[model samples]
Target chain A: MRKINSRQAGKKVPDYLENNIVRFVYLLRSEGVRIGNSEVIDALQALQYVSLENREKVKTALKATLVKKAADAVIFERCFSFFFTPPETRERLRELRQQKIARHEHQIKEAEQVFTFRGEKMNLSALDKTVYAYMPETEKKRLRDFLEMNESRETLQQWYRPFLETLVKGRLRFWHKQLHKEIQEVIAQRDTGDEELNAIRDAAAGSGYGGRTILTEDMQHITRKELPQAAALIRRMARLLATRISRRYRYSKKRRLPDLRATLRASVQFGGVPFKLKYKSCRIKKPRLLLLCDVSGSMIRYSSFVLQFIYSLNAVVQRIESFVFAENLERVTPYFQQGQDFERTMTAVVRESGQWGGGTSLHSALKALMMRYGDELTGNTTVIIVSDTRTIHHREAALELEKLREKVKEIIWLNTLPRQEWSSYTTVAAFQRSAAMFPCNTLADLEQVLSRKFLSA
Target chain B: MFVSLEKLQKGFTSAGYICDEEVILTVYLALRLEKPLLIEGPPGVGKTEMGKALARIFHTELIRLQCYEGLDENKALYEWNYQKQLLQIQAGRVEGRYGRVDGDLFSREYLLERPLLKAIQADRKVVLLVDEVDKSDSEFEAFLFEVLSDFQVSIPELGTIRARHIPIVVLTSNSERELSDGLKRRCVFLYLDFPGIEREIEIIKARVPQAGERLTAEIARAVHHIRQNQEIRKKPSIAETLDWARTLVSLNMDRLQGSTIERTLNILLKSRGDQRVFREQIGADALEKKIRSSLV
Candidate 1:
């Protein structure tokens, strides 16, 4: 083992040889030192000793060898202790539990867990559903046993006593989680179900109880997936529109459009000479951007960015309608909220829609959107179809696209397919009957696609 | 860090930033409150520079923690030096320094210090800048709050080390990723935006004092154009603007006209992303639109 005197008085041997500074360093890490990779490697190299039994020694070697930078040495020292630190879990829990008890110790009113037995249908409130989810199987069985032991409500009440204490603890934890959830939600439903727990000795209450919530809403709150931040791609487009500068017209208002007041003001400046005055209006458009995206497997990555682009466009795309179509078309408007957890929400979307990872039946999916939303498309519609058109087409599908081309003013097809990947003539000639095709690989291209001036009026 | 921030800003007097005393003061108040000040802005608006400047000004010390994917407390704070301790025992026999040996060698004294520790144990109030924290994994964010709540670090060996005085903590993110609520609650949030052309021109003069007035105005106008063009991947960051200004100063150019712009495009834009976007917009066509818009 390498050795060196840590104190300044002695010659400092290399760490690989036996050294107090080195051993202490490694011990700090194993016993919980913040050891960096370089330190460990250096210490091991110095000692030239290889074995798992000397884990602490290795850490010490690293501390002596690696920690040369002062700030780093301090950080390493703090980290060693932190990693090795026990965190006073007991004391923190005691304080937390006391606080929880003081806040939530009790005033129970009415909370009933509604069950949907076979063939019975009843609307479950958010509270009822949450209670059901939070109830453990053991407690549920106890409740069931209690119910089975007696037919009358009074007898049931008698049986629920012993288990009441444990349930109270969990219940306090539950609502504390809810308080942490959405302050608005907690404020929304505050006094509807609670009063002092007189009938039962120890029931759930307010402030003190805190824990990880077991309910879906609580889970959603923690994961940030409870709300949607956008309505459609239009909002995103709007955001883009807000931060963009348009091709400004030379004139404030076009002479043809006739800005009477501006002209009069200019004439007044000219002392009523009333010479020719030009005017212009801002060229920014508020077009209804109808974004139709393909959410099939081949288009997953591109689809996400397309969604983000649509989301970012805030005011640019007016009344955006987004439909993710694989084999079926699903509108995911409610899942785009600011701070929404996409992982949780998207998982739910894929599960609920059940069509995301399936197939590409774009033509039929368009048909579904058309039938349901025929009124939304005007004569001046700009249909932005974002896809590479990957299909196991029942060739009859292309006819519907042709039909769609005939209806709207313009159809812009954004191909996610790379430039080199184009082997099919369908893009160059097939859909050319009425649609404009552009190769889009990145957000920049998508921006260009959406920015084309089709209709402003 | 605010005091440090002041020093750093003074150092870069020629970059043309009119340091809003109000914004700086607000940040100073937040730091005093031990709140994490979050600065958000489009890329290149000088979000990261603020942190670097604060580190320099503090004199107490600057501890920088660059955040990225899979970052954990171990990387940010510390880990054990296993090899060193083993060797210490082996060498203990030779010099008879064995009596002085203790496990506390692996303690705080021998422990390596990271940014977080430097800030906590500063002789003077330090500045702890958790840069691009949003880029790190979200799970680790919960742990961030635990430290923020106390301004302390718990070391099993040393028991605990808390801030003797809370250091100024600033977090800068590009909003490329959303931060967790746990973290958002612990800090004061601010979003930095692009300053207007007039403000930017003034900034150029202030930050780059030697820059010619005409050159500064032209560069600022060009920067304004780049910001307007969303097609570019790398928007001209304040840093790039400084570089362009410096280049112009060195070249002895008084004004920015067409050819001068082409020569310096590489300085303003680092990659193909910026180059392509710049090419698409910064020419006669773009200028025509700019002029036309102005005329009416």
Candidate 2:
């Protein structure tokens, strides 16, 4: 155990320790852990009481003072271990970073030598060349064609040489889109050669954190080991959502008219002066939910997560009707009502439905649902459709959804496809026109959409 | 208050609360810094017990405020005894002494102190346990901000009631809902998970000394095995484990036999669904075999 001198009463914190704590706090904030000034001051003050001889005591003190949520605890542990390394280890890590930077510079130099335009040397900066090298073949070909088409001998002579470079760089920037800055950052970090430092930076930045947290990880990519943790998170989120919905009814109770009979009954103790007035107990109308999950091959992973989420809400939502669709719609509410293990329920649902992993037919499915369960889709019902919006006869499906929207309170489409790729699928745009569509490819996305949309509604 | 972490641990042990160094460290720091300790975990993880243990260690009163839906300031903090006030008003009018009625109505005599106010006005330090705070409404949670941070509560009639002695406050949550960032900021957070098998065996031996060593070890192992079943909705809590051990001891059982577990499983698993799953999925015979294997 490494020991440091404890701060005495009415004494200031050592400058080095104070700086480390501030840096650690900054790292935590960057990693999405919210820490306030009061917490920092408490941590410093707490350090005075605990013996510095015990490392665990110091760590526990800081963690208790700083970290509030259980979810942020993982990030705190990682950042703590990284921040509080021994001096010799930190020095070695610093040297390793310098060595990596040297290797990155060498690679950049080599790339610059081979980066030529039209058999003549192109005088582009190392950053520009690195970005150009990272582009795909198709984008590279497009860039070459654009240069060939735009750069005429006369124009090149009339304009400055730097103008052509600027023109090429602008096209490269446009091709990279939102990722242009991130790519530039990666290249910049390469020059620093600080792998551990970069890891900490990336972890703190919440982008490409080491083995991305299960919440932010793609639903389809969650491994067998992480499945239990993912399920727990989903259950926790469902309970939270249920609580929010329940709170609405609690608030609505206050708005109810006074109960005259109960007020009079209670006034017997006070000689009928009516000191304690009670509100009329309102019957809570639990929100009716209709879940339509697409269990086609393309959307099975996302559908499983959605089904699990809905199943977890069974205790809270009394009037939920679940349905699964592939080539046709099949009501699977019975499977959920059985209240068995979710995995077994899912297995039974897949076995009995006969539509699992088949092609999607949203138009036919919606029509079938309307024909069979038309009475169930009242104005109080909110229909949530989980799909990638990849279906046969997209326009007809969109029309059917619009019709369903008229009969229901709302239609929410949770599209499994990433939002960036939505433009590529005409079906997504078609369904989006009729319903409020949100990306549901990850737990974070699902959480954001559900909390924002459902809570507001 | 304890001067060192070791003494705090020993105090907790003597108080019959089995905990690790981390828990002791957190409690020590919270006591030293005079901050409210926010303990969150799954149900039956000894969160509320921590408060009770603290009270025992300090020889202070354990003032508990059980939070729930629609809980408000009138229930948690001070409230004017309206019936008494009305009677005073009526009597004053009858006696032609109305001038003194208004002043006396809102006085300390008419102020009914709830748990929050009671803790604040206590002559000596006490352990104020705000249990299941997540079950309370957001407005009530926000109202707790003033009491927890500055140890003071403001009444419209009475200006402000600062704590006579800063009570050691322990707030426990099952995480049914996410607490506000503002409430979390003013607290020292500690998460208490279920103890491991060895520690749990220690707990069983400590709490239920009537049970033999083999029986305690077998019960701990059996509970641990049952907890590993993800399909079991409600895992056996430590309290439930102790109850099961006590039940077995009362029944004059030395070991967890398959038949005994089937008969006494109700004590461990509360929900019918969980019991059914435990029987159908994690069979008693299988758990018995696993427990017996440890002996070999």
| Top lDDT hit | 2
In candidate 2, list every pair of residues with a backbone clash.
A97-A193, A101-A193
The sequence of per-residue lDDT tens digits that candidate 1 reaches over residues A170-271 is 553454444433332333333311111110101111221221222112111222131222122223334434322221112234335655545543453333
Residue by residue across A68-152, what tens digits does model 2's lDDT show? Answer: 9887888888777766766565445545555755765765675565444444656776556666666776877777676666554
Worst 10 residues of 1 chain B by lDDT: B8-17
TM-score of chain A of each: 0.38, 0.68
- lDDT, residue A320, candidate 1: 64
Per-residue lDDT, model 2, residue A333, is 86
The estimated TM-scores of all candidates read 0.42, 0.82
Query: For all the predictions, what are the DockQ values?
Result: 0.02, 0.48
DockQ of 1: 0.02
Candidate 2 A-chain TM?
0.68
What candidate 1 gets wrong by more than 4 Å, as runs, is: A1-457, B1-17, B56-58, B93-102, B284-296
